[model samples]
Target: MNFHLLRLASMALIVGTLAACSTAPVSTVDPSPIPELLPHGARAGQPAVTAAPATFAKSRWLPVTWSEVPGFDSDTLHEAWNAWLKNCERPTPAFAGLCSEVRRLSIANGDEQRAWMQAKLQPYRVEASNGNADGLLTAYYEPQLDAARQQGNGYNVPLYRLPAGFGTRKPWYSRQQIDTLPEAQAALAGRAIAWLRDPVDALVLHIQGSGRLRLVEPNGQVRLVRVAYAGTNDQPYKSVGRWLLDQNLVRDATWPGISAWIAANPARVNEMLWSNPRYVFFREEPLEGLDAQFGPKGALGVALTPGRSIAVDRQSIPYGTPVWLSTPGPTVALNRMVFAQDTGSAILGAVRADYFTGWGQEAGDIAGRLKQNLRLWAFWPRHLTPGSASN
Candidate 1:
């Protein structure tokens, strides 16, 4: 799954396709097309395919037939039922009524699930205001790293909790200021939940938003813990990889490429780290029982399903909505059902999404290079009127 050549080749093809399409003639028809809606009980026997445009904060949704969704019949719908069930934990107002049926279908077969979806939902192609149906897809995952409860044994980089008066300060402190200033250091003095050996590993934890830590305590006991995102310094996120690319320090900006550059030039590590002013804080959570089997709680306040969950711009697609993701790729061909259960600072736009690839080193490797072209279709409740739900 971590094929660099495949990623590069696919990206090149996507870019070429985009370039060729850019010169094509534009359609004169209205971009935001409104269709007639049927009464709730009118479609008792068949699926409703036409509905008013589902308007959201930043995007529009036009109803389309289920057949229009690529790979609709091929995807293993039952595999995504777990994610759908998770969505029930914090169902959006528009989707609240369907939670019971969603729970009931957890044990159903793929055909049964697909049939239920067709009976209860309408498929809408997600689009921007200008009617662009294409966007970008990226991936993210949880990092699992070893750590020490106390600062010793070469574990100098500390993972801190939010400082006192964190909210009172407008922008808090920048990463460089936190690293160099005594006042900033004092504020976060005893906030360390664990200490990591490498600053780059700490950076990866911050960027990924959450991670599992193999903590070695004072009593010589070992345990696994999770550090979930609590807050940031309110500073903008700047990509260190982008910084390296801009400076011509590396041909590739992925983590592997960055790590190689770091190994070669250790002296300039601080310079590279400080390029991104934002610093994220975390709160520890126990990793046990069923929680250990699942990923971190997403923005929707539910555990995310690996390969079945996606982070989207809330303005475009509301949380709890089931999405059909399609991408023609040299990296990975994904035509499946995924749920909108998370949101990220970088995930913005009608069609753009960040696919959650689960945890561990293998997941990290896949996530780091998963940038490609994407198209999305939202499956919404048939009874709910489009443009009526509050995002």
Candidate 2:
């Protein structure tokens, strides 16, 4: 759901100081954690985000062809299918009827899957209400960092859990306020679930919303866990990168550029951190077994597929929808099937989308730098009211 700050996304957090964030405070957090050791089921106090209706999204759906979808026949269907299967976990009513058929086709070959998709689903080229057929496409990935169970040995940056009365507060505490205020510190006492070696990494975790933390316990043993989005202080997300750019502090504005600026202006790190004011709290989930291999669960409550999952404006393309994303750009030439399984704060607009490129360094590299023009076709089940699709 994010990429407005992908440059150092693995290390950066929050979107630009948008009008909302500019006037308001900055953001703080994201979703999912390991299930086996710390299953996020029936949690005692955690809140659930109730999704709203997508019927208000006004996008024209013009009939298209498989031929229009570049590389449609060549994509590894099995790879995309994994994401599709996850969507089935919480499919929209439109797709719920087709899950049985979807499961039956799970083991089919790429060619068969392609054929089945073409046979069963109708392609609707998604166009904006203004009749624009193209939009921007960016990338985001899961960040991995080393953390500690305690705040000693320079691992002082604390990743907190939700504090009491967090729901009652309009906006929790900003990065600076939280760090400087005694009451804020007192509220967060005993709530530090984990600690990170670098404050920047903690910032990255906050920026990315969720992260994979390889934590070192007091026993000198290391274990991996997902410190996922528990809740934010409810502050609007403000981009630290954008703040740096507006101040003429960084010219490149990418992750590497931010890193250079941090190195050269080490004294200003807190300024950068506090400029956006948003802070994210996390829920620790164990990352052993199969959970270690997949990405954090998306808004759809499904494990996202690397390179095949996308975060969209749910208002435009509802969750569980399959989209044929074609974008010819310098950073990445992408023509593949992606599922709308996630949503982000910055991924607004009918034509906009954020591509999830999987985990680790390579995914992080692509997420930070890849931004391109996009054309998309959202496929729907054919039997839904044989009539014109309206914008």
Candidate 3:
């Protein structure tokens, strides 16, 4: 599992409460303006006066024309509309007014959407304060696993909910303590939301912060449910993959390599599990009808649209912002619009992002190996000054 952890509600509150500031150093480079792309029969209006470069806490935004964005004209805007609509659900003050028009344009053609964007939004090249445009991109996905309401047969590992008085302990019991200590066990007694067959799957669920469980109830009814991140044990997160790499136990530190090592050395499974001190707690959520089609609710408190949702550092890019992501990759090349509807502990930087691949095994496979070079462009409303939290 890639490090897309810590999509907790508390983190969302932090992002939501950041006061808008424009004190970071701005870039001095200026590219010549290019002609805007417009739909057929659309009249050319007076170009909006260009504004000075804006600065956020960790990033600098340099205004650029629509033509500068790679694959901007080619992307199917409607495909990303679902994510945009999700952003509208709890829109930042800057984007709240655009929701209605965004809703109306749900069925708009690519050309029309493109035209609308050009008319209403400004494209700004996102970069670090020191002016580096190149950055890294990783991917994360929801895992699906078979679970049971009660531990039995092969379902020996328990996925627990937050314990009573969990807040009293500054740092709750470590993973090993939770497994071995009677006191910790007592606190977690009767707290198993579901039981899984493999401890590795439990670890993956912990890392991904949410997953879909094909849960068999006590009554023998099997229903699909979602386990979402409620909180953590307040321990520091250490990567087991990094530990394996450091120990020289595995050449590939991805999930597959880790799984292979675990299979070969079954006795040391606990050793590997305990390498990461952090443990996540989850709460069960219903998965029914159209809800089943979406991924877990992100830190933005909205259902993440698989290919179009990305977890970004809120200091660099605010939640609910529309971002244009471009990456040339050995794993997968992408040049599309994605929404910044999630945040992660590991996703920290102006250009760094974690692409949300949809759930299941295939999504998991891609997410495990997807780390690529990336460039980003953020779209802001034409009327509002960039970095301001107002319409």
Candidate 4:
């Protein structure tokens, strides 16, 4: 077994058991109310929701290295991925249809990844960071290159684009940077290697679910890859309790008893059982008696307002710090938002974030399209601390 799995399993069993016993349910409502946005220019309508006073406390900014994080071990991470996959449900007709397409593509060729992204995904026009016009969304459809081989193979992909000067330094990557700087070369090359080895795994856990990889052909042909996509799923624990109570599966259906019944379910044989929709997907964060909403694209785009979102993390990372994201997989670009407004279940951590693509079939299409690496680097007020709260 992967060492990480063993550790996480050991830890989770304890947490899971206790989680089943907790008196209070997890709160879904944003602890702090969503602040109303001031009109971009002037507005004739009444003022939008007023901004809440910043709740984040001051802390020294620390560069938390993701690769060094113990829980990020590949095998353990793989367990989580496989778990999510096995319990994956189509949140909408478009997503469900996309899943069918992905399954179909999977059947024709053993390459499930490519089938989902190419034949299955809906395409959109996009612009490169350099203002070059291109496909808005590019889905990577090939295996990643080994680290050592990436230096010689320049095949690369694009993920997402951020406003220029978004990070701490200006011109984050100069035109001649890759060829001129050894560090940049190593970083870029290391990225290529990581993606080729385990594109999906690398992207989801380590890279903030974003990044670019190279798909080099023996014939020396290369193409751009994109992996920005998302799908909806249940917040199992909360959902399970609600489901059971709603269906009269249990009496009272409180967190403790409901959780115990869930854990005790004969089918939950491994730690991966957490992925079961009964416990994973939630209608809301705190188990509010509300049904989860499905927007046209998905929740991320709704929360972030993609084109209109901005940074705002007062406690952990500063509100304006520019960030650089690195994920595992082939993508249209490298580097995306460190603090996008959109959010969801799987996306909850001080160091974690979600990039909204759109909703419904569009969102489902985007979710199906993802398979890459993502890295983040904060720009404004470079001197900020990481926070404890992740939501």
Candidate 5:
């Protein structure tokens, strides 16, 4: 989980009592962080940040008013209720008391739900310790792709599961090493879960962590299944997109742009794949096309809500917390309540969040193009008797 923390109420003073014990008691209270307001130019497509979003020097939670959250009231809170319910399946002990109430409120109207929030939760705006509220918001999604039950013809790329003794050593094998080395190939020889045509498609699936694979069996029968994250080779993840950018080969850095570059430089595909030594393995699960609509389960171990689920740095925001997010610009103007249900490698920083854009091509389009400004307001249970809690 992302490290997402606090204090107690003052002791009441007795009035008109023996009071020579005076000087107004210089209490050593650590000041609550003051929130930073977003700049006027802040919008959806680009960040209006005062500095680099990733330069993250320091960050903290600053208590904020619900009014300061742009679409707090107007938002369809009920829309995110399902996401909240999913959170309860493995909620932190601090939120145990409110799960029942949240379930009940799920069936209520928006205004009624709004009332519940107003009464039960307090908003804390996430900001840099230096007072920068503006940060970057990218997105991720589940992608569905075609596969072959047996390797042949146009379908030749193999997506393998962990082979025996693979985890015994650290940094088992890099992507290029796995493809070229006999030892690595031996481990995966008889363990091909499925095969695909484009190496890039498999790479995309690996990056996303989970996806639906439409398999064409030996008998020409079609089957759909999910490939969930199993394990990684323990190597560091390198950004292929960044490599292309640094090489001056792609002007637009989105997925589409990268795909176009790949098509032109087909011979360099392995180079791009090798750029990231990190390799992920997967385990297949049964999934029909219709069932895939609900979205694959996220890091929270619960099915994600489309457009309502988000991936935050587990170090900053706990897996099951609810967040009020507001980030507007050219791509999309989002002011809604989303659950922090997942986390990612690239998603780092206190205010950093990745909007879960759901599944398929459309969601992929949004996820690919999304690189905008973001701000967050975390809603925590008021009755949470604050001593210590994940943020």
Candidate 6:
């Protein structure tokens, strides 16, 4: 049995408020731990922390040393990336540039691949582009798991796990490893440099917690997305979590124990937890008025993922810039992108953004009620348009 399944089974039988079911919250240890990907001690609790999309910071921009780029020759991983690209459709503007490059490198030998990589690096040989590429990219932060007994709004909310019977090899790449590989370093460094030095264009959005979503595709198809916020409301690894911990909202001192308590409670997870005031999620498809998903699960695909969507703002920002969102949370600063274009449902004017809240009741609740102002910055590649000049 999978690890989460065992917990789920035990939780299914429980019935009561989360607070009623657990003993007095225990103090946790290690008080704060470094996040999985970000720099050590970089968390959300501090106010006036250096602002991000950091696309303009020279300090974060580093040169890509030659040794840092990876060798694509005789490398299975490189070949796999090429293979994946072959399956994706072409002629779309997004892949046109990469597609051409792929074709040239497809039949090249080791020596040829090296030469090609060098040539590719010739034009704007620099490290880190911030986070902008021609296409788009989004960051998905795995939320903190709770293990306590305090039931509230998110009670009975269904938490979706990686589907059963699906096994795929997990790939782990260390920052050090990437730094040692020239090509990989160059590419990532280029993007990171791009993000850090440029203004944002696209802002892809995703949220943690349970809610319904509505995706209105270009072809007029609507899909549903849902997630359940069954754990404590505090966004761990964020400034919010730190504050909540200080405020006693996070009574459990340890992450593991806290998570165990949440799993045990199986109800009203969101009510007692810290939340993002800037974001308002829905219970069902906003358009359809459906019920929210129950239990401790969520669907990022259907809930936060947008469908064939594009956004545009003519005044304050330009078109075609990729945005890395540092959401209204405490922990991780880099979120997803919301593309920039010339059209949308409710998005209009400068500094205005319309996030694709997915489809359905949950979507309705979140999108319909969201009218408050939120802080967000843009990112772009310095090459495409210098960050300072663009902003």
The lDDT per prediction is: 0.75, 0.70, 0.77, 0.27, 0.68, 0.27
- What lDDT is reached at residue 202 by model 5? 77
- The model with the greatest TM-score is 3
Q: State each candidate's clash count.
A: 0, 13, 0, 79, 13, 108
Ranking by lDDT: 3, 1, 2, 5, 6, 4
Off by over 4 Å in 3: 1-49
Across 212-264, the per-residue lDDT of candidate 2 in tens digits comes to 87789989999888888877776766688788989999776666788889999
The whole-model C-alpha lDDT of candidate 4 against the native structure comes to 0.27
The regions of model 2 sitting more than 4 angstroms off are 1-56, 386-391
Candidate number with greatest lDDT: 3
lDDT tens readout by residue for model 1, 1-391: 1111111111111111111000101121112212223332233465655577767878888887776677787777776888888888888888888989989999888789899999999888888988878888877677789999999999999999998779889699999999999999999999999999999888777776788999999998999999988888888766677788788888866555777899999999999989988888889999988788778888788998888888888889888889988776645678888998878655678888887777777676566557778888898888887645635
> What is the per-residue lDDT of model 6 for residues 43-136, given as tens digits with 9 covering 90 to 100?
3452222222322322122222222222222232232223223222222233234456656666766567555544432111111234321221
Error of 1 at 304 (Å): 1.0
* Residue ranges of candidate 6 with Cα displaced over 4 Å: 1-65, 68-98, 107-111, 123-240, 249-255, 263-270, 274-391
Clashes of 3: 0
Is 3 or 5 the stronger prediction by lDDT?
3
Model 3 lDDT per residue over 1-391, tens place: 1224553211111111110000100121122222242321232453543756889999998887676777787777887898899888888899998999999999989899899999999988888999888888877778889999999989999999999889999799999899999999999999999999998778778877888999999999999998988888989876776778778888866555667899999999999889888898989999998898788887787888877888888899888899998877666778889998888876789998888878887776666666778888899999998879832
Q: Which consecutive 10 residues in model 4 have the weakest lDDT in total?
A: 1-10
TM agreement with the true structure for every prediction: 0.85, 0.84, 0.87, 0.24, 0.81, 0.29
